[model samples]
Target: MEIIIGPLILVAQVALNLFWWALVISAILSWLVAFNVINTSNQFVNSVGSFLYSITEPALRPIRRFVPPLGGLDMSFIVLLLIILFVQNVLARLQYSIG
Candidate 1:
């Protein structure tokens, strides 16, 4: 049981780290789109944007509901990233305590 649980925790940590990168990528993509630096009509750009949206939207939507954007600058992404970091820290502490 210890062996199995240890590997599971490591996998979870990796997953959270990957998710953190995804959120960062999504935020940057959004900025590019907003600034018209990337053309959404292009198939590749559109597809990538869609993929990012699908991945990040589920987590961000709820946050958006309660915290509306201020002056057209959305802070929800930042807030979500911070939340993910906090969760990652807690998970790390749990793994340390267990081991």
Candidate 2:
């Protein structure tokens, strides 16, 4: 049981880290799109944008409902990122205890 649980915990940590990076990439891509730094008309850009959106939108949608945008700035992404960070920290502690 301990052997199985240890691998599972490690996998979870890696997944959480990947998710955190996905959120960061999504945010940066959004900024680039907004500023016209990247053209979505290009196939590569469009595909990358779509992929990032699909990956991050599910987690961000719920946060958007409770937290309204301030002025013209959308803070939902930031809020979601913080929440992810908190969860990652908790997971890290759990992993340490288990090991």
Candidate 3:
């Protein structure tokens, strides 16, 4: 029982770390999308952008609702990235504090 619980906790922590990393990449890609660095109108770009949007949009939507665009620049991506960073730090601390 003790061995199982210890391994499970380690697995959970690793999963959280990977998720935070994914958020970081997603945020960078979102910036690219916003800047028109990779035009989504192109067929290949559109497909990839659509897939990324499906993954990240749910996380971005609430931030989008509360944080409006400023100076024609969307700030939600930054906000989302900051939130993910906060969450990752908190989880890392929790992992240390636990074991």
Candidate 4:
């Protein structure tokens, strides 16, 4: 039981780390989409954007609220990424302490 539970927790932590990384990548892609480098009207782009938004929005919405758009540029994503990194480091340390 202990062995199984331990690995499960590790896997969960890794999944969260990967999710944060994915959010960063998706955020970058979103900027491209906004700039029309990637066709936002395309089905593929829409699907990808929707998926990323679902995962990242909960964390990002608050940041977005406080930081309004500036000169047509959105800095909320970068702020969200910073927060994610902070959380990731904290979680890593927490896992270390647990082990």
Candidate number of the best lDDT: 1
lDDT of 2 by residue, 4-95 (tens): 87788778879988988988888888899999999899999899889989988988889889999999777988898788789878877887
TM-score of each: 0.92, 0.92, 0.66, 0.71
TM-score of model 3 (CA atoms): 0.66
Candidate 4 per-residue C-alpha lDDT over 1-99 given as tens digits, one digit per residue, 9 for 90 to 100: 656655766787788788878787787887798778999789988898898888888877889889998998778877876776787677677666667
lDDT of 1 by residue, 17-92 (tens): 8988989998898899999999899999899889988988999999999899999988889899899889889888
Q: Which prediction has more favorable lDDT, 1 or 3?
A: 1
Q: What are the runs in model 1 whose C-alpha is more than 4 Å off?
A: none
Q: Report the C-alpha displacement of residue 35, candidate 2, in angstroms.
A: 0.9
Clashes of 4: 0
List of clashing residue pairs for candidate 2: none
Q: Give each model's clash number.
A: 0, 0, 0, 0
How well does candidate 3 score on lDDT at residue 14?
79
Deviation (Å) of 18 in candidate 4: 2.4
